[model samples]
Target: MTVAVLFALFTVLLIVGVPIAFAMGLSAVTVVLMFMNVPLVLLPQRFFSSLDSFPLMAIPLFILAGNLMNVSGITAAIVRFASALIGHIRGGLAQVNIATSLMFSGISGSAAADVAAVGSMLLPAMKKEGYKPEWSAVITAASAILGPILPPSLLMVLYGAMTGQSIGTLFLAGILPGLVIALFLMALTWWKADTIGGQKHSRATKAEIGRAFLAALPALVLPVLIIGGIQSGVFTATEAGVLAVVYALLYGFVTGKLGPGLAWHHLRDAAIATSSILIILGGAALFSWIIAREGFPAQIAEALTTLTSNPYLALGLIVVALLILGMFVETISALILVTPMLAPIGAAYGIDPIHFAIVTIISVLLGSITPPVAIILILACRIGGVDYAKVIRPFIPYFLIILAGLVVITYVPAVTLAVPRLFAGYGG
Candidate 1:
């Protein structure tokens, strides 16, 4: 009765256009008043307690760092470098979009940030280069989904916090699968370029290549610093985020790309973005607390265990259920709402927390690229000046390719576990 009431109210509020954060808060409150014995005074305490975690400090700092890089002209340099490297290929600008995401993913860890940083620069170029604007939008959005799977991912941070998994292990384990997704996207872009040939570019001289690399180096350095600091035990994830902000600011100013005015504007934007995420996180935390206090997680866990004693079957169900839920809810919201309930069941199966985190992150990522709640896709379309319908069609094949990648990573735990194990072994 408690879970049902919570679900029905949340669904109705969402359908009625309430913001997801408020919807979660209201629904949780409703559930408490209707079904639970808890008092209303507990709400404020729960909300505040959610934000009290040290690790969650990374969320705002990373968001600020990403927005700062955008305003500081770091984004432009990386796009230029990507274009110089891939712009001579058959689907030059398209490849540039994928490459740029791969680069920015290390720094920002948010797919929406990836689209904003890289898409704003590349989408126009692809349109001007005779590529269909809609196709350009589709590919850019599709490729940006790789952002979450890459290191420094906010999803990884959330996963770690919820599951008690090591953030360092999640970061290290993500590198290879992220690379595989990039390579596959590149190949798909090449084939699409062949089918719809655009204006091609002349090969660049070695001097030009060197200049582009030098120009792109600063943008490239932020991710390495964050990931390295975490893996080397020099900083916790939260500390790494603080360092990322400092590094982005220093790089922007030293490069003469970020002046006081742009820095101020960036700070404003970052605050708004960070606040949005934090609100959602806070609300979901309250909601999850209510559900847990009602003993819903334990109830659901027992039911799931009864259905399947086999770990593989349970994990498979998790992936499928997440994919379905992803269709309705946004990825970040899905992660917050589901991970609390599922993590314990996964542990009972002897599943590595890091491996479970990878599957959880990737499954939610798949949802971010699909219909009904594709925030990245919508943002890409807005920036690219293309209709949503036209852009979505071309994404079908690329989406399937990415789905295949997700499936393999879901079942083959080694792909997700190898890097973390090796890194831990070497560290020891």
Candidate 2:
């Protein structure tokens, strides 16, 4: 009865267009008021408690680091480097688009930021190179999802905090899966190069490649600093975020790309973005608390186990459910809401938490390109000036490629676990 009431009210609120945080808060409160004897004060308590973790401090810092990097002109450097490396391909700009996203993913940790920074810069160039606007938008949106799948990922931090998994292991786990997805996207771009018909350049000269790599080397080293610092026991994940911000500030100042005014503006923007995410998280935390109190996670695990004792079958069902849920819910909201319920179930099926974390992140991220709430896709379309309807058709192939990569990551734990095991000697 409590679960039904909570979910029913949540559905009604979503349909009525209340903001997600408030919708979750109201639903949880309403259920508690009517059915449970819990004090209303517990709602506020849970909200504060949810945001109290040290690991969660990484969220705002990473957002700020991404914003600072954008203002500091690091993105242009990375793009130039990517272009030098891959611009000779048949679909030159399209290949560069994927490569740049793969590089930018290390810094931004947010797909929306990836689309805004990379898409805004590359989509116009792609159009001028005679690529279709819809295809340009599709590639930009599709590749940007890699941002959250790579190290320094915001979703991975949230997952770690919620599941009590190591953030370092999650970061390490994402490395290969992200590369696999990037390779798949690049392969698709290469295969369709003739159909896309973009201007191709000669392979970059050795001197040209060296110059671009040197220019972008500062930006390129950020992922190593973050992942390496954490894995080497030099800092905690939260401390790594501090290092990221300090590094971004120093780099921006030295490069002269970020003046006081621009720095202040970017800081304010990061604050607003962080506040929005944390609010959703606080509400989802309360909602999760209510669900857990009712033994909902165990019940879900039991029900899923009854349906299929096969671990592979259980994974398939969870992936399908996540993809479906991703279309409706915001990715962070979905992550916070589902991780608590599903992680335990996944464990019961003998799934590695690290493997499950990568699968869950990738699965939810696919929604950023799908319809209704395709945030990354919408950003790309708006930037590229392409019709959303036109881009969806071109988006299908890339989506399938990414979906195939997700399946490989799901079934082959080594794809997600190898790096972590190699570095830390612990798979989970």
Candidate 3:
């Protein structure tokens, strides 16, 4: 009855369009006041304690690194490099849109940031080149999903912080699956070149390709630096974030692009972005405490295990639930609310933690591209000056493509486990 009341209030708040942070915090507070014997002060304590994680520090640093990269001209370099590499292919701009997101995803770690940085540049270019605004907008938003799939992922950080999975292992786990998923999108774009109104250009000269790579070299180095530094024991995951920020600022100053005023502006922007995520997590912490106090995770795990001894069937059920939850809730908040409950369920089914974590993240990220709560998609729509209704149609094919990719990654553990295993003795 208490669980029913708790979720009932949360659903009502969401249906009425309260911000997720307030909705979660309010629902938990209401439930505690009515039924739970927990002191009122304990509610706020849960909120603050959840934010007190060491691994969680990576959240803002990674966000700031991604932001600084977007603003300090590195994003343009990445776009240029992506264009040089594949913009001459069939549906060239569409290919570049995916490539730029794939490259930028490693830095920004946030889907909205990917949409803002990459979409701001490519959505206009694609539209100006005779591609439909709806198509351009959908592609930009869909590709932005790569941000959380690839390394330096904000979602993975939260999952690891909450569930105690290895952050570095999750980062490594995303590598092959991330690239393969990008290939899946690229292939779809290539096959549907005519559908998207693609244009082809002559292949770049060797010299032109070389020049673009050289220009984008610094941005590329940062990902390698973080991964290599962490893998080699030079730094922990949180420290790698610090390394990323210091490197971005230094690169900006050296290029004379990130002056004091510009740096402050970007800092303010990243802080705002970071604060929003932290606020949602705080609210989730309160809700999660109530859920924990009620033994919801154990109950859900017992029910799931009793229903299905088969791991794949269990995963499919969880995926379906997550997919449905994602359409209504924002991605990160949904992640926080569920990871605690889901991780134990996966363990009961004998799924590898690393594999389970990646699959969980990919499924949740689909929400960012889906409607009602399509946070990233909303950004692309605004950038392209198109209405939400217009893009949803074009989003269908990409949605199907992403779904197919998810199926492959879900069924084949090797797709996710291989790279992580080779790199760090993570489960195979």
Compare the candidates by lDDT and give the number of the best one.
2
What's the distance in Å from true for residue 57, model 2?
A: 0.8
lDDT value, residue 321 of candidate 3:
88
Clashes of 3: 0
Please give the lDDT score for candidate 3. Answer: 0.88
TM of each candidate vs. truth: 0.94, 0.98, 0.97
**Per lDDT, what order, best first?**
2, 3, 1
State residue 204's C-alpha deviation in candidate 2, in Å. Answer: 0.8
Error of 2 at 17 (Å): 0.2
Error of 1 at 279 (Å): 2.1
In model 3, the clashing pairs are none
For candidate 3, lDDT tens digit of each residue in 210-258?
9999999988888888888888889999999999989989988888888
Q: Mark the 10 consecutive residues where model 1 has the least summed lDDT.
A: 419-428
Winner on lDDT (1 vs 3) = 3
Error of 2 at 99 (Å): 0.4
User: lDDT for model 2, on a 0 to 1 scale?
Assistant: 0.91
The alpha-carbon lDDT assigned to residue 424 of candidate 3 equals: 86
